[model samples]
Target: MATFTEHYDLIKPGTDDYYDVADFNENMDAIDTQLYQAEQDMAGVSEKIGNPGDEGEDTLFGLLNPGNQPEEKADFYRYSKTEIKKQIQNWKPNLSGSTTFYGKITTFRAEKNGTVYVKWTSSDTANGEFYIYHKAPLSILEAPDQSELGSSIPKGLQQEDFCYYHINYVYSSNKGKPTTFEWVFPVIAGIDYTFMWYASSASSLYLNEFSLGYTDTKEA
Candidate 1:
C-alpha cells in the first residue's frame, strides 16, 4: 500500500492486480499461442507417419506414400524389354501352410513390344480352372486358406491390395497331366506386370520350368 507507486509501472492500465487482471490475460494468451504451435508441429509429424488404409498392414514404410500422392501409375506394369524367369523345381504343395516359389532373371528392360508372353510347365493339379496372379506383400499374411482358383487347401500368393489386371485362361476339359501353357496378350494401360502363378488341382504342382518374355510395344 505504502509503496504501490513504486510498482505501478509494472502493472497494466485496465486492472489493479496487474498480473491478476489485464496483464494476466496477456500471459494466458502467450501460453495459448505456444499450445497452438505445438499442435501444428504434432500434425506435421502425423502426416509424415502416413495413414495407409489399415494399421495392421505389413509395409515397407514409405514404399507406398499414403494420402500424399497417387503412386506414379504406369501404362505398363514393369518396364518393358525385360525378361524375368522364375523356376520352382521341387515345391511340396499342402505341406506346412507356407510355400514360396523361387527363380532368377537374365536381363531386365524398361520398354517392350505391345504384348508379353509368359510360359511355364508344371505337374500342376488339374480338375478345374487355375489362376496366374501376381504376388506382393499383403496387409497381413493370413493363415493359408482358399486359393482364388479354389483348388485343394492351398496357400494363396496373395499380394497387397492393388488394382491388378490379368487375362483369363480356359483350358480344354480333357487337358490332364502336368503340362505347359503359354499365351500372349497386349500390354495395355495395365498388364504384363510382375506377379506369380498357380495350379488348380488338389495336389502339389511341381514347377518344372518357367520363363517370361515380352515383345516391345510402340506407344500409341
Candidate 2:
C-alpha cells in the first residue's frame, strides 16, 4: 500500500511499500512546473507595481499626487511650493520695444496666451494723451446686415476694423521732466497690438523708452 501528501500529492511510502525513484522524479517535475508558473506571475506583477527608485511612466514613483493632479490633460503638471517660488523668482521679460514720438509706432504680440505688461517713460512740456489699443482679430466681429443692424455695424470691414481701447492716460509734465507709466493687460496668442503717444503740443513730447513683456503668471 502507498499513501500521498495532502497538498501536492507527493508520495509517502507505507510501512509495506519500498522507496521508488520514479515517484521522486514525478514529484520533482510537478514542483518545477509550479515554480516556473509562480515566477512568471511575480514578474508580471512587478512590472505594474514597479520598484522604489523607478521614475517616469508606468512606475509607482512617477505617479502624481491624487489631490494635486491637473484637471486637463494638456495642462502642466502641478509643482511643489519651492518649484513655484523658483519660477516666479526667475520671471524675466520676454519681449521689449523702444520708440520716440518721432519714430515709427511700436507694436507687440505674444506667442502664447498670457499676461502682458507695457511700460514707457515720456518727457513733455505740456499735456498729452497716451493710448494703448488691442487690435481685434478679423474673426472678432461678424459682417453686419443692412436690413437688421444699421450704422452701428458697418459692412465691408477689413481685419483692422476694430480695436479695444485699453489704456487712456492724460498727463501734464513740466519741461525737462520725465514721467513713467506702465500697464498690465491680458493678451491672446498671435494677435497684434499697438500703442500711440500723442501730444497736445509737438514742441517737446519725447518718448524716452517703451517696452512690452509677458509672463505666464498674472502677478507680473
Candidate 3:
C-alpha cells in the first residue's frame, strides 16, 4: 500500500510496496500546474509596478509625478518653483496711460488688486498742487481752484466722494528744472482712478508717464 502527504496529496511509496509509474506522474503534473499559475500572477503585478524613469497613466510613478499641471488641475501636488514664479510674473495691470496738464485726462478701471505708478515732471514754472483720486472727479472736469488746494478737502468735492486721495504741493524753486515725482498707491480691483495737476498758473506740470503694476501676493 502507498500513503499520501497530507497537504499536497503526493503519493509516498512504502518500502515494501511495488514501484508505481502512475503515482509518480501525478505528482509531477500537480507541481507543474502550481508553478505555471504563480508565474502568470507575478507578470500581472510587474506591469503596475514599473521601473524607474517610467511615465504614463498605467505606472505608479506616473500617477505621483505629473509635470507642469495648470492651476485648475493642480489639487494635492505641491507647486514647483517654476510654477510659483510664473504666477507671480503674470500678475500685472492691464491698463496704462500718460498725460500732461494740457493733455486729456485718462481714467482706468483696475482689473485686479494692484499698484498705480504716477510719474510726472514739473514744468519750468511748476508751482501749485497735484492730486490723485481713486475715482474720477465728475463734478469738475478742470482742476480745482488754487485756493482749494490749501483746504482739508478740495472745495468742490467732499471727502466721501473720493475714497482714496493724495495731495502734493509743488514749489516755485522747482521751476525750469526737470523735477520728477512719482506717487505709488495700492488700488482695488474694479475701481476707476485718475490724477490731475492744478497750478495757480496754468500748464505748470507735465505728466510724463503713468503706469500700473501688481501688488505683492501676500499683501493682496
lDDT for each candidate structure: 0.40, 0.48, 0.49
- Poorly placed runs, candidate 3 (over 4 Å): 1-104, 137-163, 201-205, 212-220
**Highest-TM-score candidate:** 2
**What would the TM-score be for candidate 1 when compared with the true structure?**
0.33
Model 2's TM-score against the true structure: 0.39
**Of the pair 2 and 3, which is ahead by lDDT?**
3
lDDT of 2 by residue, 93-176 (tens): 111121112111345555777666655566655455544446533332222211122212222222344444534444455675
Q: What would you estimate as the lDDT of candidate 2?
A: 0.48
Off by over 4 Å in 1: 1-110, 127-176, 188-192, 199-201, 216-220
- Rank list by lDDT: 3, 2, 1
Extract clashing residue pairs from model 1: 80-110, 80-111, 82-109, 112-216, 112-217, 113-215, 113-216, 113-217, 114-217, 134-195
Model 2 clash pairs are none
Candidate closer to the true structure by TM-score (higher is better), 1 or 2 = 2
Tens-place lDDT digits, model 1, residues 1-220:
2122242233234444333455556656766787899999988887666564523323323433332333332223233444554333443344233232221111222253355555555554433233333333341122122222222323333433431444333243334356666655454433224433433333344555555555432221
Give all candidate RMSDs, comma-separated.
18.6, 21.1, 21.2
What TM-score against the true fold does each predicted structure earn?
A: 0.33, 0.39, 0.38
Q: Comparing candidate 1 with candidate 3, which one achieves the higher lDDT?
A: 3
lDDT of 3 by residue, 1-220 (tens): 7889887788999999998899899999888888898999999888887775555667765555435334433322332211111001111111113112222234545677755444455443545465556754565434432212331344444556563664555665465565666455676888765544445443334433333344232211
